[model samples]
Target chain A: MQGMSPIVKNMTRLVAGFIVLFGVYIVLYGHMTPGGGFAGGVILAGGLALVVLAFGEEFARKALTHEAAKTADSIGAMLFLLIALLGYAGGVFFTNLLPVGEVGKLFSAGIIAPCNIAIGIKVGAGLFGVFVALAVFRRAGAGSSTGMIEG
Target chain B: MDPVLLLLLVLLGFMLAGSLIAVETRDLLSSVICVGAVGFGTSLVFLLLGAPDLALTQVVVEILVLVVLVRVVITRRDETHATSRATLPVGLVLLALGVMAAIVFGTLATGEDEGLTMRPFGDPLLNEQAEASVMAPAGEKAPEGAPARMPKSAGGAFLAHGLSESQGSRGTGAANYVMGILLDYRAYDTLGEATVVFVAVLGVYAVLRKVGRSRHAGNESDR
Candidate 1:
């Protein structure tokens, strides 16, 4: 296939960058907007994928390491579970142990916002890790196919 | 049309288009994109339905599915495509369409009005509080320093309305009251669901890692 023209490539990268920024905005305004952790996380991942496609896979790998992704995923899940456990100790599971503050405010959602952040990290990293693992497996499969022919 | 209804219609349109694509596309990757579109539609619907909780869950699950599906498609990119007859597929499609149409029409005809106040969940507690009449016992009333008794309408205070007579506007403890209901009243069920999610994550991680490692080993052997 012919390589994309310079203009097209630049446009793609620019759009991807915009998407990533918009995702952040949605996530932060989750309570106010029609978006939240899951929506924003996927959008962020989409931007990352676009960058990889436009630039190169190496760029993405360098920006996001497998080890770091795994650690982030684990930590996110653990923090969420800990929050729930804390609620349990307080005689409620998933209870808002923290103050609720004023409704519709940034800090108003209490534990909900933190929970959303945890979910975002967990989902984004877990998804990225899955893709990485699959790519590695696919490469191995290709190598094996080639070997069979050689033998 | 009302803004809410208009939004709902838009979401429904997306859902329809996504389903059509998912069913019509022969390529697995294209089908996966269709599924993602369907997820986007559902998330929008959830947002309109005043259920942010469900919307968040849907978005996260959709990403997980998209990632796994894309990985599969890329790995199998070199595989050959197999074509099938269009006649049988068309016939099947017509039959499915007819069935869906009949079901939808029947359900709509029988369904209650959207504005219907009565529901299968029974009368609302907010409107029926006078009939239920939950009041705390005299001795149970807290001393000056103790936490205030929760109201009947407040979450988790289903058994005895601890502070029905009190005139304070839900007090400064509204958040605590709600939290108590969510955690204390429904702890067992919520915990069960959380445990299930936790286990699923572990399962996905384990299976994925094993798949990766095995493929790596196999590739080395082949080389």
Candidate 2:
């Protein structure tokens, strides 16, 4: 699909970065703030969706391919599972194996921060992949025989 | 009425109006937008209720739902007007609403006589009591046959003992109680939820991949 006017494209270029950065901040400061991994990840996906909406399908595909999203999703999930499994060394599943430092600090929450990061990545990538899949499928079914399916 | 309650009532009114408009709208796009407005209103209610996490989640979910619904509406060119259904479904809905109202009123009529205590909204007395109990350590162990002396409210107990050094156990180290509960206290549950989301995304990918492949094959066969 062709993109929108230059105005929309330029605005998307200007705004998408700030949205993504805000999402990252929410995810990273999840332990101290109201927004957590899930909320932040959805925000991140919204940012990506904004880009897709502004620039249309082709540009989004080039920036974040379906394969890349799938890989990120898998990696995020695996990383979360790996973190959980690592707790086995502490003689229990999902044990807080890391040292608990002073509270309110960024690195103070043992395992919770890392867990949030993992969940954030997983949720963001997974939602983006779903959007891409749905968008591509709709495009393909709409008389575009040579759309994302072959790619 | 209290100012917060008054504001909540106004928001609820808007939400109800939005829902009604969404149901009655003939234009699909307008209907989707109306539903999104309802969702946004509900999220605002959540925020006003002091549940920022829930508000954030609701807002994000609403956005995603809006995106998907808009996409679906855009793709399907047919059926511009929504068909009006029979009155039976509406009757059933009203009946369900009546039943829910009856249940709620009946429960409220029962009062706090059933070993339930009603506390003032946003009162910190329970927290203080829990803190006192934690500090005393005298009532930690009750007689085997006697009643338990723990705090009546579980949340206050969590706040008192879940994060700090208490009861000869090291509490969850996370400063944020919600994170502590989710990742440290009940990490397995979070893992399961993550797994569910993962499976859902994979299912979407698989379904789309199959459709794409079949369509491609059909095009090739035609050629």
Candidate 3:
């Protein structure tokens, strides 16, 4: 699909970076702040969706392919499960096995940070994959029923 | 009522109005936008309730929902699918409302006076009592080794003792109580939620991929 107007493309180029950075910030600081993995992941997906909206489907596919998204989604899920399983070494499932440093600091939370990261990755990739799939399906539907609907 | 409560009431009113408009509107795009407005208003309500975490989640989820729904609506050419038959839906809604009302009234009728009456906003008596109970010295133990009984109010106990080193119990090391509860104390539940999300995404992928492949096979067969 062709992209939007030059204005929108230019605006997206300028704004998408900051949007992504903000999402990352939210994900990283989730343990201390209000925003967590889920919220930040959705925000990250939104930033990417903005790029898809501005630059169109073809450009988005090039930047973030379906295969890559699927891989990332699986990797994220595996990482989360790995973290949970790792807790078994500490004598219980999903236990906070790592050392809990001083409270109120960024790295103080033992397993929470890693858990948040895993969740963020999983949610972000999963959402983007869904969007791509929907878009591709829509394009295919349009192709098959083009003249049938118009006439 | 406090000014904050008044403001919250106004926001709730707008939320209701937006939802009503969203349901009543025939134009798909307008309906989606109205639903988004309602979602945004709900986030504001969460903020007013002093739950910034919930507010953030609500806003981001709303954005994602808006994007996906708008994409779906825009892709389909058949936007005028509004039917005049509203009896079944209306009746179902009324039934649900009746159930909710009955539950609320039943709780109010059967609940004890102490349980029914909420503490005044920003009351500190509960916190003080919780601190006294949990922070007591070892010498104040009742019998053999059992410590003094703690406060019945879980919220008060958490607020008073969950952050710092109390009598013999070590508080959850995390500064954020919500994170502590979700990730540390109840990590299994969180894992379950994550699994649910993963399954949902997988379902979407499977359904879409199947449709695409079937469509392709149909085109090839026609040739």
lDDT of each: 0.56, 0.76, 0.75
Model 1 alpha-carbon drift over 4 Å, by segment: A1-21, A29-33, A140-142, A145-151, B1-21, B24-75, B79-101, B110-205, B208-223
Q: Which lDDT tens digits does candidate 2 get at residues A1-151?
A: 5767999999999999999999998889887778888889988988988888788888776887788888988998999999999999999899788887766788767788898999999999999989888776557566653344443
The digit string of per-residue lDDT tens for model 2 on B1-223 reads: 4687667768877988899889887888999999999999989988887778889889997998799789767766668655677666878999988996775455334344635533423332443333235433355633222223434454544543443453111355555667777778778999999999999998888766744365456568668
Give lDDT tens digits, candidate 3, residues A62-123: 78777888898899889989999998998888877777777777886788889889989989
Per candidate, the number of residue pairs that clash is 1, 0, 0
B30-140, model 3: which lDDT tens digit per residue?
Answer: 999999999999899888777898999999889988988897787677758678874668789999989966754553352346575444433324333433455444555
Clashing pairs in 3: none
Mark the 10 consecutive residues where model 2 chain A has the least summed lDDT. A142-151
Q: Which regions of candidate 3 deviate over 4 angstroms?
A: A145-151, B86-157, B163-172, B210-212, B216-223
List candidate 2 stretches off by more than 4 Å: A141-151, B89-151, B166-170, B210-212, B216-223
Could you give the CAPRI-style class of model 2? Answer: medium
Best by lDDT: 2
Q: Which model, 1 or 2, shows the larger DockQ?
A: 2
| Model number with the top TM-score | 2
lDDT of 1: 0.56
Candidate 2 residue pairs in backbone clash: none
Rank candidates by lDDT, best first.
Answer: 2, 3, 1
lDDT score for residue A108 of model 2: 66
